[model samples]
Target: MLLRIDHVGIACENLEEKIAFYRAAFGVTVVSQEVNEEQGVKEAMLHVADGEGGGSYIQLLEPTGPDTPVGKFLAKRGEGLHHVAYGVTDVTKAMAAMGGAGVRLVDEHPRHGAMGTSIAFLHPKDVGGVLTELVESPAPRPEQTKLKNG
Candidate 1:
């Protein structure tokens, strides 16, 4: 059901500080950063090198407003791993199976994810006290594919 480990979501209060830290610590480059209003968060993605083997990415998630999900998470957990995202080939199918078996979801349908993917969240109450994310890719972007083909 799961294809690979997608990006891990980390909760951060100041994205610039975190970005600088990550850049200096791991030498990663920021690929994109955007605010997703529907999901209610601002996110920054730091790309990892392909030849360095395959850990996905560094996703810096900041709350959009004082009442957002990420905001609540920060209030509760402080700065830490917010969620573990698992890549699935088919999010709809995967979510259906999980739902049929009584898993609680944060969303019924997948929403826009960073890096051109679809995403859904599983409630922490149903996942052994840890929040989880299910992500489905919409095929790699053309330039990304070219990087692979090269």
Candidate 2:
């Protein structure tokens, strides 16, 4: 089942500048940052408000190259809200339901996402012009904790 609004993603050319803006404007700092080579982007997650366990966040994305999807999006649209992600209990099941309902999907199957979550995207044309993502992030793995500490 779809759980909650996970985060709102924003595409940008410069991560540091935008990070500074958010830090100053909202008093928020990035909680986590990573470069997903598979996605060809560097992303930072900043907590906006506390949720039941973790919190909701704003995900800042900076494309690694002009060939990446986010890079193409920035080149065309000039940096803005890219997608809204919803947390899900099972991304595969969610995608199945969406496909059965005739929703166009960007991903035919779930793939590893930032922070080791499984994710899939629904095409914007099928979802009222908003690119939507389903994310299923499990509890932090042991390696994740180690990386955070060291």
> lDDT (CA) for every model shown?
0.83, 0.86
State the lDDT of candidate 1 residue by residue for 52-139, as single tens digits.
1223777999898779989998998798898888878788898998899799999978888987788899988999987889988787
lDDT (C-alpha) at residue 52 in model 2 = 42
Model 1: CA > 4 A from native: 49-55
Best by the lDDT measure: 2
TM-score of each: 0.89, 0.88
Top-TM-score structure, candidate number: 1
* lDDT of candidate 2 over 48-121, digit per residue (tens): 76544335689999999999999999999999999999988788888999999999899878988777789999
For model 2, the superposed segments whose C-alpha errors exceed 4 Å read: 140-150
